[model samples]
Target: MKKPGRLLGSVSAAAFAILASSPALASGTLAGSTITNTVTVNYQVGSVAQTATSASNSFKVDRKVNVTVAETGSATTQVSPGQTAAVTTFTVTNLSNAALDFALVAAQQSGGTAAHSGTDNFDVTNVKIYVDTNNNGSYDPGTDLEVSYLDEVAADASKTVFVVADIPLSLSTGSVAGVTLTATGREGGTAGSQGAALVETTGADSANTVDTVFADGAGSSDSARDAAYSAKDDYTVLAAALTIVKSSKVISDPLNGTTNPKAIPGATIEYCISVANAAGGAGASNVAISDPLPVTVTYDSGYGIFLNGTVTSGVCNADGAAGGSYSSGTVSGTLSSVAAGATKTMRFRAVIN
Candidate 1:
């Protein structure tokens, strides 16, 4: 569904709160009111604008900007990673008068670590920011990493940062991310010209925001972030957990004679791994299960089944060990969600030779 972009129509005084014992910071103390304005969302095709760019003239109001980072079919076309998806966009717009100067020191869009070229838009050369991985949003040196400045956003002009988040790579997504950006302005030497805003972002969407944009479609995500956070914020939140889980190991029969549950020769063993969302955090997708076929059976050359030529439910029974580079039977199963404490099991059997 294609919908018209929103102007963010309203602003709350609470959105900003600025104070100045010294009257040299900004337009106003930013203490009482708020400013909300229009911003053109740079989505691919089906993308929807969550809110208009909001800010404040009073330094006391402590202006804020909320943005949502997501994948679009293309920066030029669709909003989400449609059946066939392509581009990635990071949108930001300044609601203030003078042009906005976003100091980008370090940043990446799709992978684990970004290849920030010597290029202009992608390179976050040399600035610093306080990252609140804990979600406190406040900079805590003990808990946060002093990440360098990343890509910048234009003043009042909503802009998008493009990247490739798709899979299959010799080079990693570096660090998959819904990069949350922050810092006060610094293009100028004036007092509050580089002022800070109370910024918020949408959670990182799996593909697009349509399903995640509304409350009706959140499913497990509703509970994970399950908050009013935006796409960018969600990405930051889940990114932490995803980082931890990505480090988990997949089981495989080691050729080494060392461990317990030693590979038995000529014996069939049913392997069942039930993935449970042990903690109520987030769910993982595109999980690949791998294990070395037991040494007991040999894999059939033609069919890649067990040497004994027996097959069961998602299982291969034969002389325990399989042939031809450790055979694998299937990669089909959908665990819609492994909710907190909920488990999804994948079973594969190996026969002993």
Candidate 2:
């Protein structure tokens, strides 16, 4: 009743106040009925005994930047053709008055082989980054994460997410870097709203997101061979055709469905993909097998498998892109190029819905 008195939503309101004040129009982020990154509001209501009403919305965004690979950093060290180094920067700008709800935290590899290896030193950790949630260039309600706490980053102020991804030194040698990554976050404590509802609703523009990437290029320090790029430059490469040999492909492995059948919740069937190479295939590159994790899963790096990718209810992002079935798990790992045609077998276990 009474239009629920006006919803409160802001993505980065504090940034606006801290950066520089905009007058005249009382405008920009504060002027709009909704703003992303920051959150704050003031309302005037008719006196008298009336019902107390409230409203909330969220935001989301998907952005990325690709960088080039380097050979080495130290002068004593030689630049090798196989080894690589690079960094990416993702900026989250708050336009709201109230502090940005979340902070910049972990980095997730949405669909790539480069992940959080213990060797990472410049990795941006212990922070919560926010997304537009809806990629609408604006932040609102429902599309945010509320797990971590973050005050306003202040309007006009920006937060940077640093990522130092390294390439493997093997036959595959990295014709490319890593896969796409998406920074996720919800409204932060600074929003001062009622908070997110786990079961009530999942709104767009409500969640936080930062998805912009910048990649560079560099020459191998020890190019005991020929020289490629003199300096680091950004480039995009298609997925390399890794050597793979099929050992098993069971669409309906009733036995696996019962025995190893995805232990993930609601998983009805399981697809086990395993492979072996004479060179152990790849060395220690991150191998990301995308399919569907229904309940919750774990990427057992030791076994190169996901132990808990369950059969959950979350909707898939792209169709036919992430692959609906793990009939034959793809390898984005590290190892020899497989003798240009070395034979290797892989087993992908999928849980049938």
Candidate 3:
């Protein structure tokens, strides 16, 4: 047969030059995986030698979408303007191999200028986002998983998300706010469906060598493969503004001296107490400040109980010398720090016995 028709056209031109110089075995496998190849052919009938084998087709890899976001805790937290700020966890991972559906959004960031400048603009109230469900990363309101988005993850699986916010009592006291959390990739619609398509680039093509399943670059919207993810956190607000004042003076008056003062039975009063702080506010740690002993007066202990006038009745300082503490009738003090507009004073001496 003309030497088997030139030996089948020299085995089809050597299998098209070994598949055009081995382009990675005809690229195509990963994603949903499947690749099988086999080929063999030898000829020499004149010498009674021949062999031919080839039959094995399988190459199907398509379906790739990725996602990853993290900020699981303590990215910076501390709040009290209306309270309720301590839950900014996030996990959302599904480096997709298949089975995907995610969509969740939350934003509240402003022109920040660092440390209490314009206070970084503010707006945080009620905001909530949940899905931890027993994975025990915390936030168990009714046994976890309260989805507003994100239904199926499986395929590298991972989902912890939680945002819970509320710091707006008029926010101000070193005010600061920034919170962003986004995760999108709702391929075929289902959870709150809205015609999803943040990913899934149509089998992604690079000349489609049998569909090589996006190694990044198909219809690539590139969010690391369109699974998309974003995360940011920060909330700071700590307020403190205090003020108190009380006064009385008419020292020594056996009956009525120091300008017609008469508390009867050997009078002698001198009670003052002032404690102020409120400039930019926020700075009043451990500051005690107590006072109680007025059954009509009768505490003198040699004219004791003085802080700024310093009789050393129990230490309290602000140039008032010593830190603070008094006993019995109570006249406590402990101003570890009170700056902001600063002011501290406490004096004592009474008798109407």
Model 1 over residues 268-332: C-alpha lDDT tens digits?
Answer: 34444445444534445554445454444544333342221222452333332242234364322
Residues 88-158, model 3: lDDT tens digits? 78787766566567878867776565222334677787888888878879887777765667776666778
| Candidate number of the best lDDT | 3
Task: Rank all candidate structures by their TM-score, best first, as comma-separated numbers.
Answer: 3, 1, 2
What is the descending lDDT order? Answer: 3, 1, 2
TM-score quality measure for candidate 3 = 0.38
Find the candidate with the highest TM-score and give its number: 3
The count of residue-pair clashes in candidate 2 stands at 114
Candidate 1 Cα outliers beyond 4 Å, as residue runs: 1-235, 239-269, 298-337
- Deviation (Å) of 348 in candidate 1: 4.0
| Stretches of candidate 3 exceeding 4 Å from the true structure | 1-30, 35-57, 68-87, 98-135, 139-156, 159-174, 179-228, 244-246, 255-259, 262-267, 272-286, 290-299, 302-324, 327-331, 334-353
lDDT, candidate 3, equals: 0.62
**Candidate 1: worst-modelled 10 consecutive residues by lDDT:** 239-248
Tell me the lDDT of candidate 2.
0.31
